[model samples]
Target chain A: MNTHIRVAPGDLFGDGVFETIHLRPDGPWLLHEHLARLVRSAAILGLPEPDLSELPAFTGEDIAVPGVDPGSDVPRALRIIYTGGRVHTAVTPIPPAVLRERRDGVRVITADLGVSVRRRPPWSISSAKSLSYAENFAARRWAVRQGADDMIWFATEGYALEAPTASVVWLAGGELCTVPPAEAGILPGITAAHLLSLAPSVGLRAAERMVTLDELVAADAIWLASSLRGLAEVTELDGKPRPHSPWTPRLLTLLGFPATS
Target chain B: MNTHIRVAPGDLFGDGVFETIHLRPDGPWLLHEHLARLVRSAAILGLPEPDLSELPAFTGEDIAVPGVDPGSDVPRALRIIYTGGRVHTAVTPIPPAVLRERRDGVRVITADLGVSVRRRPPWSISSAKSLSYAENFAARRWAVRQGADDMIWFATEGYALEAPTASVVWLAGGELCTVPPAEAGILPGITAAHLLSLAPSVGLRAAERMVTLDELVAADAIWLASSLRGLAEVTELDGKPRPHSPWTPRLLTLLGFPATS
Candidate 1:
């Protein structure tokens, strides 16, 4: 990716939508799903339909893209950012910390998002992956300061919603579950949703649930799911240690991530 | 000002702070107060103190800077955007719509912000002029689509909080009042505060108080206060027409804005 891009000052105000995809040797994982979401997000912001014809087209199964080095074992992060006026695409190397988190798991905390799910503004854009991420970044920074690697956000009344940058996924009563976006009023997570759809193949039932913090703590296993991280096991939640879940490697491999990690 | 700037891809995420000042022939309006708030906002985001020493030093009163035209009658819009890593400043001619809004008044509507002031996360940046303004822009876009010129945001319980890019100020009984930033969890409006401080000189008392939407509708006169527009009287509220407020001109002139609009 270029180190710098030219932009009008107004473009810096975060009035845009973007998606990050895991670019493996076989091309971007769930590329179609991510593109579809980008369009939905743009509509929510009243932005024009993005012209994505320039992208390589594929059907059903993922294929090796012309851009990727087939010999390379490491995956890249492919990002597409679209405002009303422009679309920018960049391919970047995945960070070492992301890989490390997936390998060793993360320490987590829960915080109230201070928003009312029932009273969301008629024009609320919280469900879109918009570029206004200062608060999201601030929340993550606060978690780091509190000595946790990450945090899960809940609406007032104690319902677990999502992490600052990931989706909350857990195993409870032999079912694989994630929060439903519309009810939770959060960005729909492509990684988590796709993982749950594949749960049946791993002998697990898929479900969408609204779990409270206490309920989440009592789950069999918890993970934060995202594009690059795949699934980062929650090793510790709210200062309490949890045992390693054997299902971590199984789910990672199911999502096309390196299972050994 | 340059038409475009160089920026890293990460910089476009809106993890920054900004301030827009009304740059009159006498220089930036409320320059000191704006700078002070800018620092306070940076601190809220855990950013380092912005190196503002490069800006022309001024004390007490605004002054004509070496960069502005001495004979120019029109005031420019001066802006400062800081993102911990960099500070950028620009000066440009004010837009005609801002002038028109000041002169003709605006048709306004109110919407629920869906946030809880009491339950707000400890890392809330609502009191800071952070650059994550996608929702603010989205709200304004929604208002325009509904055929209104601007909007006032309210907390879930009907408390009138603020406008998308301005502060809520109104005349109640004999007092000139604006919403208190700390209580409302809105950004402290430099223009509104300065206007209130000068109210006593105009034979009116100043105050900061919370009022509900029903109470706001009954106000003698209401105006949205900001740096560029100065004061935009609400000509209509929620489809109900309002008579022109006689004090609009008086307040504009007092704030160094042209009384003639």
Candidate 2:
């Protein structure tokens, strides 16, 4: 956890981009995909493309030093933050709340985000994961205040958009679906996209389509997908109880994520 | 400028609130009003109430120190930034761009911000001037890229909203008007509100009304008011030139701002 970086006070305005990568014993998981999406997010923010060569490679040697507990199955979390002044990375142990959600699942509530897909400003950075995350943090805080673990946001038109920090993915019949990023003008979720790419390999059809809250609730199973959290199943929607799905374990394994507690 | 604050890397998320005040030879202008608004903005972001007693006071004597040209007519800028870590303040020279806009005015374009007044999320931080200003910066950048100095945002229902960093105020005959903050769910502009309060002294009626873009375009004159910039007149709207209004200079003077270049 020896992180080093210097930035001006103005950088706190969230006028930057960042990526969170799952750090396994082997190395940073899906490093290339995360880097690519980081570049894309920077472009959306009108920032200069980041120099990938300048990034530090996550070598497994850090976890394999003599006397270290290499036998431990727990994975660390890696975060790369890039502001105007500097780029830096940090590694920290994943919090217990994330593990709890993965194990016992979470209750999720849906609310209107009040954003109009048709009226996105010309410089709209909605599709970019910029650092201006107060609203996102506020949404999660509101969920916690409401006695829920997380919340899903919907467009003003009533289309299910995304979670504050994750992408919404669901299983409906034989197809695995997520909201189309381009159509909804939301940040394209790298983990969700990667999982959708592997859907065919798992003998499941994948589709990207706009869905309503009602339609999402009627789905066979729902999960909030992200790089670090991997996949946290939705055990309840609003106040209604939802049955646990057997597919949760299978999908976690498919994504190279640990399924056991 | 003497600044002595040090913060950690995690402080750059813009998950806080800020206020910019006009520093005059007399003292920091509108100090109490600015402090009050800062507290309100912090409340919107769910931050603990700002302890005003803990803040540094920028007295006129502090600016009268040797080597600080005592006769300089240029107004200083005071900014207060509060985040999860701490609250801090700084004094700096106002940007040349802000002064230029005051003298020569600005050309503005109107774009739909795509947010719904009635449907803001439970955790919506729109009414607060939170530190997560990436989108605000991006919106201004977008306006600059589109061949305009700035932009006026419209709600999804076609009602004229505020600017990226300023409040929209327009003159209609004898009435001075601004958008209603509660009805529109916009950040209440302290400067605009103060100006409206002074309208009666200048023999003009003042009001807060929900105006359409068309109505804004048809106004006698329109200006975006903020702490740093004072007031910037919108000389052009959607590429159409507007007739110069005599009240621009009169109002600036009425509000105790420098009336000439």
Query: Each candidate's DockQ score against the native complex?
Result: 0.78, 0.62
Per-residue lDDT of A22 in model 2? 86
lDDT of 2 by residue, A143-253 (tens): 999989999998878899899899999999979999999999998998899999999998899999999988998999999999878889999999788999988999999
Scored by lDDT, model 2 comes in at: 0.84
Name the 10 consecutive residues with the lowest summed lDDT in model 2 chain B.
B1-10
User: What is the Å distance of residue B30 in model 2 from its true position?
Assistant: 1.0
- The 10-residue segment with the lowest total lDDT in model 2 chain A: A61-70
For residues A88-179, write the lDDT of model 1, one tens digit per residue.
77666688989999999999999889887888888999999999999999999999999999999998868998999999999998899999
lDDT of 1 by residue, B32-140 (tens): 8999999999999888999997665533233333355646665567778888876877666678989999999999999888887677788888899988899999999
What are the runs in model 1 whose C-alpha is more than 4 Å off? Answer: A55-75, B56-75
Tens digits of per-residue lDDT, candidate 2, B9-102, equal 5666678888888887678889889888889998888888877887765775565323457567666787788885467776666788998898
Give iRMSD, candidate 2.
1.9
Candidate 2, superposed: residue stretches over 4 Å from native: A1-5, A61-74, B1-5, B61-74
